[model samples]
Target: MPLWTIYHPANTYSDKDKQDFAKDITDFYTGFGLPAFYVVVLFTEMAEPAFFVGGRPASDTVRIVVEHLARHLDDPDMRRRSTERLNSIMVPYTRDRGLHWEFHTYESPRDLWMIAGLFPPGPGTEAEKAWARANKPLPY
Candidate 1:
């Protein structure tokens, strides 16, 4: 189960755009065996001039970083080559230049279940319960 929480400036995106973004995320997870239903997405919109860093407005700075990541999606060596490039692009705009951002990934079996009193769990509920029992930490 992959949960995505997106936070952006208010009015920056529309409802249709949000749905399309969700579809993209769902497709990405489903390709790895996790279906759309198992993915949770939350979009939080903030007003313009509402977010600031180091006393400077975050309008242009935030857009630049997001656009850069979106542009490197098709690179075959993205994970290896684009690592340093992203950091380099973000240096001049920020207060700190030495700070770097790195991406990491992992895969594991996930379990989902529902409680009888709270909500009735549908299909795959039993499997998730069993997996939860074996995993030690039950994630509802």
Candidate 2:
């Protein structure tokens, strides 16, 4: 269950880029046995120039860094390497020497029962309906 929420200044991602990103991330997680229903990715764009450390404008440098990090998401070593690279390059390159780029990751055991219970049982044989009815009231 990896939910990716990307936030960056506007005009950052092309439609092709967005599609590729969604496909890659969904495939990656599902490959590891997480069902498609449990994984989601959201992208948000901001239009105004952002402020970085030292009061420098983010437009000057954020795009390159964002692209670089996005591409590296598939790398096995990205967890360690990406952090180091971002901290080293961004702190010095941005207007604010102390400004930090933020990335958040989270995982949780998927509650398939919760998802299944959200909808009525699909058409099935009488036995199937009986089973579903019998099991439907356990407070899932």
Candidate number with greatest lDDT: 2
- Tens digit of lDDT per residue, candidate 2, span 74-110? 4658767745643443343233533235653432322
lDDT values for all models? 0.45, 0.46
Tell me the lDDT of candidate 1: 0.45
Q: Name the regions of candidate 1 deviating beyond 4 angstroms.
A: 60-140
Clashes of 2: 3
Compose the digit string of candidate 1's lDDT tens values, residues 44-108.
Answer: 66566785657965543333212111112346576556445434433442325232223232233
Q: How close is candidate 2 to the true structure, as a TM-score?
A: 0.47
